[model samples]
Target: MIPPGPKAEKLAEEARTRMLNEVDERRDPHTNATVGQLLDRYMKTLDVGRSTHGMYAKYLEKHVRPFVGRLKAGALDGETLDSLYAELRRCRIHCTDRRGVDHRTPRPDECDERCRSHVCMGLSSTTIRHIHFILRGVYEKGVRWRWVARNPVFDVDAPRAAKPDPRPPTAAEAVRIVDAAWEDPDWACSYGSR
Candidate 1:
């Protein structure tokens, strides 16, 4: 209280602003709702076709709910979403450790030599992007409805689509294919070639 300077005034103003923001957030309803609840609410209000709605529910259940469902709708941030995306990229199945198991074997008696050890395959970038899309939609709705003040997903980046790696036939391969096709007179007639 004894400080008397421009800097002291600035510090006091910042403190007051921070306190006010905290109070506002505490009073927000979004802060009281979990991400899972938000997703459920969004799903219920969605107006897409039956199949599209089913697909959305499937994506949310398989990719999103287990990761951030328990988080507060208002508490999500770029860092939290980024971590979730990274985890999904590392393993689509969300493997806890290197422990191997044959997922095909429904029972111990059904175990066979064909059942191989578990392999971790990361989620496709496209699917992850879809998940991100669903999240963005949900959060945008929350912001529009005033349930949340901002959409945290707006700060996060969705995974980019993978580039196509095309492998055209080499010169020799093209020649061999032409020779093979020419050997079949029926193929020439089918193509209306003399």
Candidate 2:
């Protein structure tokens, strides 16, 4: 068999060196990917219901992405996660509520009396808990991927939501309400109720 020429030999040697460098780069301990990288991988691996995946993506973008998306996965400690959680709560409280028939934006002063009473226009505990849950799930995924040492959510306590009061109407109150409803001329007369 004829021997390879000098030009061919030089090209082959260069290609081999490039491949070895790539392998070494992949093996290097110092070249770890970032949290964002892992999140992308996690998103791809998700086999959840479509609605759930959409919800997760929304929370990730709104709450987690801006703060720690670029951070090294292994470097995100409990403190950082805790701070992010707090910020999310704050954001939810201050978020603008623009939905209504008139489409008019209500000023803080025009908000319901309850909303105007707090230092930081407060959110319901349930909403705060939901934000916490989202963060907890993301961190749990990090743990599974060996990115975080542990899920910080385990250490932090989620806000306690108040139970809805059970206030069934009394017999007398129910009778009064039904009578008033029957007396309403608009519907009652239309329905032939005297």
Candidate 3:
């Protein structure tokens, strides 16, 4: 609903250009941009390896973007992020094929295991940590660009991944046990105890 004037014509032309272009530069760069908008900008500015960028993109697509996509970058609060992490910690991923087909097929033997419930497909703490890094990077950019006052990532704590405990090497210790089992005159001679 424009009043049909030179200003309206200029805005319409800009909108048309934005639609034709692959990049969405419709929003002004200096404004308090939305989380989704900033993510796109951050992704476009990545100078890392393709594989690394792909992984970051995957993390954004799979978790971070889906949750906070529409929220304004400046509007992100600690409580909202903490709540998102809580949900992510308990979230179960539905494994799918390249064709987007669900991988969970029900079998009689698997019924007892709740095969359809995806109990074992939950996102790991380490993966959630990765998502955190992606968000942190985006917000860091926001901070640098003066889009936001400061990064909100520092305000929340992500869950710690457990380190597996190391056990003594029983197989290597077995060789020592065998050596001790055969204490002989050769051992004494070797040490010049004869």
Report the lDDT tens digits of candidate 1 across residue range 93-177: 7888687875565667566788778888889998899889989999999877767778898899879988999999999999999
Winner of 2 and 3 under lDDT:
3
User: Model 2, 28-64: lDDT tens per residue?
Assistant: 2343667677667778887889998897787676667
lDDT for model 2 comes to 0.68
Off by over 4 Å in 3: 1-30, 94-115, 171-194
Each candidate's clash count? 0, 0, 0
Query: For residues 1-194, could you state the per-residue lDDT of candidate 3 as single tens digits?
Result: 44677699888888777655623532333465899988999999989999999999988887877778899887888998998887777654533322232334533343433333334355788888888888888889987776776688889886687688888759889788657746876764675653
**Candidate number with greatest lDDT:** 1
Best by TM-score: 1
Pairs clashing in candidate 3?
A: none
Could you tell me the TM-score of candidate 2? Answer: 0.52
Clashing pairs in 1: none
Misplaced by over 4 Å in model 1 are 1-30, 105-109, 166-194
- lDDT of model 3, residue 36: 90
What is the TM-score of each predicted model, taking all chains together? 0.72, 0.52, 0.60
Question: Which candidate do you rate higher for lDDT, 1 or 2?
Answer: 1
